[model samples]
Target chain A: MPLAKRIIPCLDIKNGTTVKGINFVELRDAGDPVELAAAYSKQGADELTFLDITATHEGRKTFVQLVERIAAHINIPFTVGGGIHELRDVERLLVAGADKISINSAALRHPELITEIADHFGSQVCVVAIDAREDDNDWHCYLNGGRIPTAHKLFDWAHEAQERGAGEILFTSMNHDGVKQGYALSALRHLHEQLNIPIIASGGAGTKNHFVEAFEQGMADAALAASVFHFGEIPIPELKSYLCEQGIPIRKL
Target chain B: MNIVILKYNAGNIRSVDHALRRLGVEATITDDHDLIRQADKVIFPGVGEAKYTIEYLRNHGLDKLLLELTNPVLGICLGMQLMCSHSEEGDADLLGIFDQKVKKFQSPSTDFKIPHMGWNTLTDTKSPLFEGISDNEFTYFVHSYYVPVCEHTIATTDYIHPFSAALHKDNYYATQFHPEKSAGVGERILKNFLAL
Candidate 1:
C-alpha cells in the first residue's frame, strides 16, 4: 500500500489556552493544550498542528512553554505556527520542541524567507501556509489570520512557494473555514494537480466522509480540521477506522 | 550503556532527545570526536543539506572519527543519506560507509510529490532494528532524496519506486525515515537498536 493519508487535529491556542467559540464548548471545557495534545496522540491522530493566535509577547512566551510541555507528553510530530516572523523565532520554537514551523504572514512580507529557511533547515522544516478566500471567481491568498488580502492567486502562489522550496503547502480555504460545509474540494483538487509538493487540506471538515472525500476526490495528502476534532463531532480514531474501512489507507490504532 | 547522538547542524535533534528520554534513556547530544568514539552506541541523526553537514563534519574532524568508529551506529534521515558513498543533494561526497549513492526523488507523474513525507510501511524487515516489529509496520518519513535498493538494504518501501528504507552494514545501521518520530513502532525500533 502507499503511504497512509494523514489525519491531523489542529489546536488553536490563544494566550496559552485553546480559544473558545469553536462550537458550544467553552474555553474552560476545552481543556489544556498539553493535555489535549496527549489525548489526540493516544487517540491515533497521525500528527498535530498548534496555531498560536496569541498576539501579546507574554502570550507568545506562554505558547512556547506550552509547546515544551506538549512535546514532552506526545511522541507524534507537531507543528507550531502563527506569529513566526524571523529565523530567530523559528529557532526558538524548534528549540522548544516543535517538529516543523509554519510561516504565513512573514512569508508574504519577504518571499526570500522561504528559500532562507529551506537552505538552513532543509525544505521539510518549512511549511508555507496559504489562507485563501474566493474573490470574484479566482481564489486569492490572505495573510494575518485571513484579515489581509494579497493579489497572489492561490494556484500561482502555491507554485511559487514550492519553487521557493517549501516542503509542503497547508492551504486553508477561508470561505470553508469555521463553516463546516466541507473542504473546498474543487480548489484543493486544482492545487493538488498543479503542485509537486504535498497539499495539506485545511478548513471545513464536518464528517468522516468529508475527510474521505478530501483524499479520494481532492487528492489531498492530509486533512486538517479544528472544531470537529476539538468538539468531539468527529473523534480521530473512529474517523481513521472509517477511512480504513472505506479503502483509504490510514495508520492502524 | 553509553548512548551518544552525534549532533550536527540538524533539525529534529530535540525530538530525538525527547524520544530517548521517554524510553528512560539519557543520550548525550554532541559532535565531540572522543565522546562519540567512547560511546557504546552512536546515533547519527540529522536533518540538513548534505554538503554543509559534510563540511561541518570534516572541519570538526568528526568525519574521520565516524569512519573509524567500531560501535553500533544508527543514522536517521539525512544522517542515513550522508552514510552513503555519494549524494546528489548538493553533489556531496559522504562517509562512504555504505557503497551506494543517494538520489533525489523524481516524480514520474504530475501528482507525485517530492519529500515522500508521511507514514510508510516497511517490507522485508530482516534486520535487528526491526526485531519484534511486524512486517509492513508504518514508520514516519520526510525526505526528498532516497538511497536506491542495494545489497545493504534490510528493508524497502515504495514511493516513486522501491527504495532502501533501512540499511545495515556491520556496525552501521541506518534508516531513511525518522524512526524517532514514528510513534510506538519507532520506540520499539530504537529499543531494538539499543539492545544491539
Candidate 2:
C-alpha cells in the first residue's frame, strides 16, 4: 500500500482556545478547537494535529480536556503534542481520543520514550517531533519547545528514532517557520531521502503550490502548516484539490 | 451495502472516510465484527507499529475475525504491513493472511531512510488496482518496514530496492500506501477495490 500525500492543519492551542500566529510567537485566538477541528474534518484534511504551544512545563500543563474536546466533536484522527513528557502522557492522550501523540522536546531528551510508546501503543501511533534548523552546514536539532539545542544532528536523530521504532517523523524547520515563504525543501529532501519513515514537513508553507513542492520536490509524505490554516488562508479541501490538479496523487476528499 | 471501516486502535480512519465520501462511498468505522462482516466492502487501515496493532486487534479479537473475512478487504499503509506474516518492527507476528514477512528497509549505519515516505512507482505487476495505473506512476509511501515480494505481489516499487506495492491473496488485498490520501490514481484503485 502506498502512503498518500497528507495535507494537515495544525491548531496551536493555548488555555483551551485554538490559536495561530507565526513562528510560535504571536498569540492570536482563532476559535474553539472543536469547531476548527470539525471544519478541517469536513474540508478533507488527511489528518489534524493540535500542538499545545502554550502548554509548557511552566506555562499551563496537560491537554487532556482539549484533546478530548477535539476527539469527541470530530471523528478524524488528530495528533496532540506539547508537554508530552512520559508514557503516561501517551496513555492519557490516547484515552482522551488522540489518535496519535507527537513528542517534541521529550523525544529528543529521552529517545527511549519512543520505544516505550512503541512497546505500548505501537510504532504508527508514536510520532517523533523534530524541530530542526539548517545552520552551520548540517541540520541541527532543537529541543525544549524549540528553545534549547542538542548535540546530535538531525540525520542522526532520525536514523536513531527509526531504530527505536518511531513510525513517523514530524519534522519542522525553525528557519522557514512563520515566514510562509515555502517549505524548507532542502531540509525536507535530506530527511525524505535518508529516513525510511514518513516525514511530515512542517513550517514555511505559503500557498497551495508550497504543498506541491513539499510533496513533489521536497518529497515529504505530508505537508503541515499552522498559520495558513488558522487564518483561513488555505482550506484543507482546496489544497488537496489543487494537488490533485497538479497530478500529485492525493486521496480525493 | 454500506462500507464499514474497522476502527480498533489505528490512526487515519477519518481521512479515509472523508476521502470515500468525496468519492460518493458511504463508510462507517466500527470494531463490531457483525457490522464489518456485513458490509459490502471492509477497509482496515492504520499507521504505527505492528505488535501493538496485533494486540489491539486481539483486544477486540479483530485479528482472528479479519482472517475469516470473505468479503473484499482493503488494507492501507500500515494496514497492509499488519496483514503480512511478520514485521521486524517490534518483531511481532502479523495476521499471517498474506504469508509475507516484513523486514527493515534502513539500518543504523545505512544512508537509506526508514519509513520510505513520498511518491514512487509500481514497476512490475498487473491487477485490478493497476487497471488504469501505469508504469513509472508514483504512489505515496511512508513506512520503514516493508513486506517483501511474494506470490501475492500484485504490484511492486523500488525505494532502495524493488518491494511489494500491492499484495493480494484470495479475497484480501492491501497496499503499503494510503489510498485514502492518494489522489486520482489512488482513488481509482480504491474505486476498483470497491467494485471488486
Cα lDDT, all candidates = 0.89, 0.78
In model 2 chain A, the worst 10-residue window by lDDT is A21-30
Q: Give lDDT tens digits, candidate 1, residues B41-108.
A: 99988888898899998998888998999999999999999999999989999999999999998898
**Number of clashes in every candidate structure?**
0, 30
Clashes in model 1: which pairs? none
RMSD to truth, every model: 2.0, 6.6
State which candidate has the highest lDDT. Answer: 1
Candidate 2 structure quality by residue, lDDT tens digits, A103-211? 8788887889999998776776788988888877788899886788888798899889988988788888899898989998887887777776778899999998999
Q: Go through the candidates in order and give each one's DockQ.
A: 0.75, 0.18
B1-196: candidate 2 lDDT, tens digit per residue: 5899899777667667766776787788898889888888999888766887888888888988999989999999889999988888788988988888899885543234455655566778588867887776656566777878888999988767778988998889899876765556677888888888
Q: What is the Å distance of residue B69 in model 2 from its true position?
A: 10
The candidate that achieves the highest TM-score relative to the unseen native structure = 1
In order, what are the TM-scores of chain A for the candidates? 0.95, 0.91
Model 2 scores a C-alpha lDDT of 0.78
Off by over 4 Å in 2: A1-3, A21-30, A56-62, B1-196
